[model samples]
Target chain A: MKASARLVVGLDPHGNSVVRVLRSQSPLTLVPARRVGPVALVHLVSSVTSPLGGDSLELTVEVGPGASLDLRGVAATLMLPGPTGLPSSSVLRFSVEGSVRYVPEPTVVTSRAHHTAVVEAELDGHAELLLREVLVLGRVGESAGTLSTSVRATRCGKPLLHQQLVVGSPSIDSSAAGLAGKRVVGTSLMLDAVPRASDGGEWWNVVPLAAGGTLATALGDDVVTVTRVLDAI
Target chain B: MLTALILADSRFPGGGHVHSGGLEEAAARGLVTDEPSLKSFLHGRLLTTGLLAAGFAAAAARGEDLELLDAELDARTPSPAQREASRAQGRGMLRAARRAWPSERLAALSRDPHQPLVIGVLVGDPYEAALTCAYLAVSGPASAAVRLLGLDPFGVNAIVAALPVEDVASRAVKELPALGSPALDLLAEAHVRREGVRLFGS
Candidate 1:
């Protein structure tokens, strides 16, 4: 897979901004040729550069004024131990001035696999945003590997949100510090323009941000139901 | 250490007894019918929301920006009911801690400082603050389960004692994530809207 991704937006005085993307050198690359929706889908069919485990990624995505982008993964990222016997990692840095919607597929942690994803986003006050993530601890009839995910976002030099989570190995003794021995966890954070409140039902809970946004967290035994609850709100 | 012990006391007169930490509604939902279930429920809370509070408390003890800490915690806590419960407890606890510890830093804060921040200020150490926060997370619920469910006090005490406090405290000081149990978060909100005999201030 391609090891790195760079997206830089050049703002035009006439208001139309131009975007340029830097491709990865590995098999893990974003398919830029397929242009349709606001999603940036990643392709991980072959990892020749990545000898043992999944390839590591250093990805930076920037959206300039009035230009929006959507980033998504092609499918659930399958975690497998690499040469160093370590899990894959993705470090994402986002600069947003316009609207950006990221609807990625769930990451399914397989046995002995490990993955960590971290996102640090800087947003303008007027920028609209939608961010979603889903994690399935293990695939069908298998034990999940280890996973840690963190997102720290700021808007207009003000603190917006700082959250990190670790979904440990299947051998962990369930605690409030972990996922409580559940198999699935999913979250959606929306900014600037949060949708209207829905009637409370399902396992999803929405908390309106004092900083002007909404955070919805849903938990279930499976992904399909959890995604439904998340999308409904 | 002595002062820290005093702060850790369950009967600190900070109005903690009034908050069951969602045990009231959890009991209503039949989620904590026995000792094992209560153990699981408490574990879910500690790893998710409890650890977040512990990290904040630890961070507060170092005397970082109290206002920023408050804002950071606000983002992590997505349940309005939990937020209100925290603010109310913070206000009450600050009042009590001010009288006991008497610091200018405590005075500078809004009458309501988040519970962990207050713990950090008085305790003055990250590990102590985090452990205190973790302990506070379960102590109230353990006591409440005794009164609400009429369960075996011995079993409840065992559950609380069995918690790997050091492990949890260490992990708490490592990070404060905006993560939570969906069921617990939703239950807290539901507990707020219900009319009649709601036991928890949360």
Candidate 2:
């Protein structure tokens, strides 16, 4: 399956954020809330079983000046293998002039599944973005297949943070320098001017980026433990 | 080749010895208590951070813009501790290289550039620079393992020798790698917050 979804949010004269353009494709549904407010709430629903091997998905989100968008996911996505044995891929691009919060639910990389996910965000001056991602290796008693996920965020054409994480390869996954044998990995990227003190634990930490922003990362045996650390940040 | 060898040498006084590359913390946590565990840690480090550094080194050696590479590397390295470690080593290497192999490119580097960029400017060959970077990435941690865990030196040397450093270097030269080592980053941060006796800087 191949799908492309687009959503654009802009501010009105009354200072209320409104969704100007919303185009949804199968498995990439965007449902906006009925409430009127300064911030627009949109729920991303996967209307169909998606992201199987050989599937390609793309989502583009743009926020105009002074607008705010709260985009969220409804449920966990399962990366299942298709019969073709090919790899699946998804690209999420965000262009922000105001603010955006993209909080997607956890994604599970099941056995035999191979997927590549990339998220690229461009923010101008005074723009803010918060992105959260939680990845589970596999279902109970099952080992993960393979996943290569990357995130690159830039502000005013200068890079803020860019990272690529690859999972699978039992050796690397179990290594102390890699995932440290953890089953769940989570990260929250906050690209705002908020100054946060450096804090961490045995398997989690929140650190300031060199250019600007803060990244909170946690690894654990279960989703709840990992998410708890990220939530604390 | 000689430049690469000298920069990779432990006695070069680049201050690379002060950083364990997260091995100290791993050993303190009992995550790498034995030879096998040390091998796993080194392997993971090689594939992720090692690959990323080697790519930047290769790019630098290919005569890429120093300012742009520095900023790009900073973007790639999210952890401030890790970034500090690299720049600290880079400053050390730069101070020494100024007298040994001073060049316009070396002067072009920022006040505190990345260690890989220093190695690249000194080596002047992409493959050799990447090879030097990838090897150093595991060699430091390997020696740190021997010191921190009291592992057999011969066994650790064997492990490091058997690692696929050449393969990683070759792959690094193809493109700039953005691989991120989450566990290593956590270990580095935890090491900074350990609030006790510490042997290595990072």
* Tens digits of lDDT, candidate 2, A1-233: 99999999999999999999999998999999997889999999999998999999999999999999999999999999999999999999999999999999999999999999999999999999999999999999999999999999999999999999999889999999999999999999999999999998888999999888999999999999988888878
- TM-score (chain B) for candidate 1 is 0.96
* Runs off by more than 4 Å, candidate 2: none
- Estimate candidate 1's RMSD in Å: 3.2
Cα deviation at B97, candidate 1, in Å, is 2.4
Output the number of the DockQ-best candidate: 2
Local lDDT at B96 for model 2: 93
lDDT of 1 by residue, A7-37 (tens): 6654455554445664555545555435433
Off by over 4 Å in 1: A10-18, A33-54, A169-182, B171-183
Deviation in angstroms for B178 in model 1?
Answer: 5.3
Q: Across residues B1-202, which tens digit of lDDT does each residue of candidate 2 receive?
A: 9999999999998899999999999998989999999999999999999999999999999999989899999999988889999999999999999999989999999889999999999999999999999999999999888888888999999999999999999999999999999999999988888987999999
Q: What is the lDDT of residue B135 in candidate 2?
A: 95
Candidate 1 chain A has its poorest 10 consecutive residues by lDDT at A43-52
Looking at model 2, residue A77 earns an lDDT score of 97
TM-score of chain B of each: 0.96, 0.99
